[model samples]
Target: MAMDGKARSAKAALKRQAMKEVELRHTVRYGIKQMLGDLMHWNKISEMGEALQLLILNAVPESALLYRNADIPLMPAEMIRHHARQGIQDRLDDLAGQMFGASHKHVIELLILCAHDAGPEGSAKHLRIPRHEITINENVSRKLDQARIREELRMGRDD
Candidate 1:
């Protein structure tokens, strides 16, 4: 009888753990989806600050709600900005070989613009190019600043 009770208890514990894992996965998925939706909406309006705030809010449900209620500060804008820049930089590094006729400066600016225009997933696609023979200009660095500024302005982005 005691052995049977132990077996039952173990089964119950396993069931509880499984249920908790499923709940956690659901919460994370919901959070990510909510954040993505907010990002898309804010992108259209060009309200970067608000968009970042929404992202932070979605990332942490309880904290975000508390912040909304008590007016406590949530995530920092600089952290989000840094994350976005780092994401762009990593993508650029991965696609360094595929960028055609693009200088390092141009690549940096293009990455920022692409991140704003396409988000992280879309920016990944934009960075992918057909790998083939390409010419590297000897003066790649000479016009980098000019190209970067030009691309930034053309894409309606600053930085």
Candidate 2:
């Protein structure tokens, strides 16, 4: 019983220490300090202020851009989640990575990929073609012309 009490006290101490570290970390002037702490942890940012700035300056702006895209979100939840989870996970994955046990990953991916700007004809990074040569059917075209000329001459001769 004494050992259990000691372990419980140790765990409580550790939790308090963690909370203190978060509080001591560079906090943004923004009102959402706890959210900043979560963001810092998620993005591997050592300072909470930097994470807050990132959310405000970078993540929000990028989502606004996606808001205009009108092409990625197959369902309402995808767009909602992307806006909810403000981080790099969405940028890394078309489905914007899993969140809250949402099951629309595959559908969102399809919608993003099928968008006009996302495929090979647009923003695709790597593209491949089977043949490199650009050739016209000169020989066949020449033969067809010759046949037409001969027939025209034959008709003239008959006339």
Candidate 3:
């Protein structure tokens, strides 16, 4: 009985010491710390990133810039949990790294761009942004045409 009591007190002391260390670590305001936390916390960030990526991919132009930039497909939560068990977590951080270093501003910009492009393209109806009239200069238009022709020629050669 005495030994058990001693062991319990030792364990309690160790836990308190560890918690003190955690408190000290969090005292410094580090920028954008995405390291692994508890499972629920990690899942929350992962789900948000995955959900945004899914929504962006589903909306507009199909070949829009956001769709292109949102290259990583979101996996089901069960699959993510399974992968986490295997030490392959942090899909959210990976998604952020791919999406211009995980800057929320960039993600919002892409979403806004999608909204602007999709308004007329008829992919997303509810979202609307003021369509800015873009005038392509003659030089830019010619260069774009040349690139299109070169791509066609390459495709023909491939065939």
Clashes of each: 0, 0, 0
Ten contiguous residues with the weakest lDDT in model 2 = 122-131
Q: Which candidate is the best by TM-score?
A: 3
- How many backbone overlaps does candidate 2 show? 0
Better of 2 and 3 by TM-score: 3
Give lDDT tens digits, candidate 2, residues 47-114.
53343333332222232234333433233231112222333334333333422232333322222222
Name the TM-score of candidate 3.
0.22
lDDT of each residue in 36-76, candidate 3, tens digit only = 12211423434433333333334333333444454332332
- What C-alpha lDDT values do all the predictions have? 0.39, 0.37, 0.39
lDDT tens readout by residue for model 1, 1-159: 256888997896687565442111111111233343444554452444334333322232222222222221233321122123333334434444445444433333333333334565553333232356887676886588779989889888653
Off by over 4 Å in 1: 1-41, 44-90, 101-104, 111-159
TM-score of each: 0.19, 0.21, 0.22
Position 14, candidate 3: lDDT: 82
